[model samples]
Target chain A: MSSPVTTKPFETTGPGKQVLEITDLKVSFPGLFKTVQAVRSIDLNIGVGEIHGLVGESGSGKSITAMSCLGLLPDSAVVEGSVKVTGHEINGTPEKQLARLRGGGAAMIFQNPMKALNPFFSVGQQMFDVIRCHRDLSKNEIRAEAEKALQAVQLPDPHLALKKYPHQMSGGQLQRVVIAMALACRPRLLIADEPTTALDVTVQAQIITLLRALARDHDLAILFITHDLGVVASLCDRVSVMYAGEVVESGSVGDLFANPSHPYTRKLMSTVPKLGLGEQSLDFIPGQVPDMSSPPAGCAFNPRCDMATDACLQPANKVLVVSKDTDVSGKHWAACHHVTGKKPSSETALSETLEEHNA
Target chain B: MSHLDQPADLLVVNKLHKTFTTKNGVMTAIDNLSFDVKAGETVALVGESGCGKSTVATCLLGLQSSDSGEIVVEGRNLLADSKAQGKSLGRDLGIVFQNPYASLNPKMKIKAIIAEPLKTAFRLRGVELQQRIIELLAHVGLGEEHMDRYPHEFSGGQRQRIAIARALAMESKLLILDEPTAALDVSVQAQVLQLLKQLQSENGLSYLFISHDLATVEFLAQRVLVMYLGRIVEAGTVAQVFKSPRHPYTRTLLDSVPSIDPARRDELKTLGGEIPSPLNRPVGCHFAPRCPRASDRCHKDVPQEITEQGHRFSCHHPINAAEE
Candidate 1:
């Protein structure tokens, strides 16, 4: 099941120091008929204490990108890129070595905490096993560490909580336990793949706040993957908008939200039902996400993008939304031929459609 | 009453009570719940999981019967003659579930799936049934080309559209959309929502929109019923409920939603605790355990429903109307 391995020399840059750096990542699954291009040349970097949101519709290669970071992709996956976690190359890392790096350097919390935990085992047993696998701690020490981790997550009655099975705890409590287990190893990077999506909004807010606090307190870099634009807006310092395998836009959350450069990003932001902005007709991307096996040519979003022109048929380069002279960290980028720094006008084609529909 | 003398209210649920006898004890699923959907109106029943939102839908759909109270639809009480009125009720009501993938039959083609209700309720067959299926699909923004395709062949949004088409197959005046777009992406969700709006306007459909997403509820619903532990804690027009939420639980629920505005980062006023189990049966207000503004009275005695200009809420310590 061994795939061809590629290696690249590690290079460090900037004072913030990156915890996870993905460069020129391309992931594909070779099938009987055709190869499914899941990820196409994605470049992402998350610095210490920064929460970078990887947002996209389903089948946009978000989960694939996250899995590649941990070298957890299926054996059939043809991964070609540099996915470095805590300065360690993950693409061609040996299985034993990858296992060692997983919980120690980077830990991932999934959407469903119950599925992540073993139903048969008590929380204490699972926590002890995970802690023991990462560190050579005594039973008492492990139990103490587990209690401390649970306490850190603000789980009331940590002692009682550890004795309970996954089924016994509520959805929010189970999520906290899962988070505690992930952070027990004190990983430098946390890849939260829709961690709060399953929980209620009230519970989700608590988890979001907890994640933000954890990142700041531990100086941990987080890669928060979700389709929720609102969650990204609230939780992330920076965001990268993915569409059909390629990142169409990347910038500081404020910059992207205020002036989304890519048509996909703009349309996506507009689609989300804003809390106070009630009753306004929401804009929607017309066409479906491209089939990965035989994706549309050039910009994947061209089929659904209203602003697309003949030039959009050719692959667009990642152009800086601001002038090139801007600071590297503050620079905003959009992979579109028409990367206007300004926001789209209020009167768009969608509003026209709404008016026509109303008539 | 005759068909010509139909009431303005499409569906009226009055003091609906449903309880399940579990291994532990009898758990009240819907406790004296009352709400109404007017003709061609969208009344959203919003609450977190285990708040009996789905129970209301099930009861309305006649999948489950309530222990007491009346479910009156179009001047006929469904509870009065559930067995006799079931067939007609099926024609009047249609349901689209939360997960489109699971709700739709994968083995069946779009045409056949949509034809089921038409066949059972109207006994439509041959070209007429085919035409009706196509028409329903067209109404949902899907085309006739999709009729032969299976549920698995369509994406989530497309599948949801198909589900909506099937729900509309019987020319149902009232649709029970139970988290119809919860499983979809934001972009796709917007598409489905827009389609729903279009369908509602075009057909003069009433919708019992059940969801936990407040933003979506506000967008689609003319009125909203905020449920907690099977009780309607608050009920009002979308503007009144969302803009000036009176109940502490309603305020908490509204505040917990992470604003899409990036400037409001880290501003989430999260509720402290999870929803209490219905089996436990908290004394007094069910939301008191999680409500930030819960007073001693809230824990000691249930607050009476207070009504003001069509807005209603049960809160011991309501947030002042002056406060935003």
Candidate 2:
């Protein structure tokens, strides 16, 4: 690890600009025995006011990708390639510079609101602390700013909320306060990792609506990370499906849903039990996520993918799944040798074998 | 009341009530809750947190005795001599908790965890006990290789499978699955749900599936009960309830779930206000405070249980068929 002091300070270019840009970003954590490849080579970009969903199962490196953008990875992590936030490189940025960049250049909210907040302190004190870290303001001015931020997230009676402690409020309200704290820094980009997973459905809906509104109104780019396909479908403008540290599919939400080319993505989409679908047998990808320390040589999802062939033994390049003639921006792409641009057939030998094994 | 009146009903709860005395005052966790699960039937109890779902599970498991209720399991009243009938009750009911990581003993191997229930409940030992553990593991999609590994070695999905295996160790007629799939990923959840469905069919297992995930309930359960503030707001077949939810709370819950269909993205209507504190519930209908179509009568008088065919809902102003 090297630390270099630079005279230059980090600054954002302003709203209506590209918020985040990643090029061939790879992150690996070095351990005693072996190095865990948490994130393989992947490219992602989020523009101003764009809500990009990073959908993946556990250990697929979705959170790692987001953490890398903010330089939040541990010191053991050897992050290669470029991670630019608001046109400023963050991959090799110093801790001081990264601290300055975070909460203002980019902010993040986690799944559990209680875990994110301090139970002992009042919500007002925490908000003030977050605001003070990012900006130099007086006590009265900071309190006003905190209240304003809370109001922006649509917390009814922001004044009352400020006096209340984390335990005094409900889960939904605590989440709102956390979001407001994140927004108090006036960040251009927001990284929400499974923000609504801990919440109830009704509360999840409210939070989703709040986030969508925040992205649109505040012109904030959001990288929403979750395993729930339904949330991605409803909230995101574009989505990237990850499997075992690699993004298998990336495209507009509509395009990806209509024609999920990647076998893993298709299998994942089919697994979500849809409402009003009646009592039907759910289709599931047979195997669990591959271990990161010693993943498969070529495609990580090949073991579970029904479409896996001998060609999949080698690393697959991102192939354009959409037609060449279409003028759609962010053209549909899948990192699979067998991207047929067709929906997955219902019957497969993989599921059959799984059923037989269970039987 | 005699369970012989309904021999087919595996587990029945008649007017169950459970109250807790908190620091502030007494809290009614469950208020006159009544429902039943037939032999090999999957009856889901869906509700958000603090809705007395867990209390119902505890009461059924005899972990907590209800204030006044008859918990009948296979023509046996569980409330009667629950202390003396502990061993038999354990054989009759097995429970799978939400978090697999916390449920299992981390220090123990998979075999010991599964054997704990079997050895204590059935008093089996030696070759018979080992064989039974293997069979249970096999039933849950795990091979003999995983029998020696500790809980830490297995993944979330695999740990959940082990939990299910232990839950089935007693061959308990009714398995109380309390948010079993909530802690798992979507793909893994699918696998577990499939395993559960397959297990139910193969062994004719009755499941009192308690979950907040409506989609999974719709998939696994034949009958569904929507709970709110410790009361059964609505009950019907999956098709009937999901297709035509009459209660306002049920409608709100169904509407709140985000659809995977991208076209219906804008249809999510968030329910206003949080669940009322159980200690200080509303005067009449518990959901009246947040009900969109709450009438003056709803707040003044408790709604009677209105039954139509097999579907029942306690709502003063139920949504009409046209509204659906």
The TM-scores of all predictions, comma-separated, are 0.91, 0.91
For candidate 1, lDDT tens digit of each residue in B1-324? 123255388888899999999999999999999888888889999998999999988888788888999888888888898674586457888889887879888889988899998898889999998999889888776888889999998877788888887887777889899999887889888988888888788778889999999999988999999999999999999999999989988888888898777777656887787888899968998888777677788888999999999999998888887777
User: What's each prediction's clash count?
Assistant: 0, 0
Write model 2 residue lDDT over B94-160, tens digit each, in one string.
Answer: 8998878899999999999999988887899999999999998887768888889999998776788
Write the residue-wise lDDT of candidate 2 on A231-332 in tens digits.
987798888998888888887777777778888988998899988879587998876677799999898888998988999999986665654333342357
Task: Report the poorest 10 consecutive residues by lDDT, candidate 1 chain B.
Answer: B1-10
Model 1 clash pairs are: none
- For all candidates in order, state the fraction of native interface contacts they contain: 0.81, 0.75
- Global lDDT of model 1: 0.85
Can you tell me which runs of candidate 1 are displaced by over 4 Å? A1-16, A323-330, A341-359, B1-7, B109-111, B122-155
Chain B TM-score, all predictions listed? 0.93, 0.93
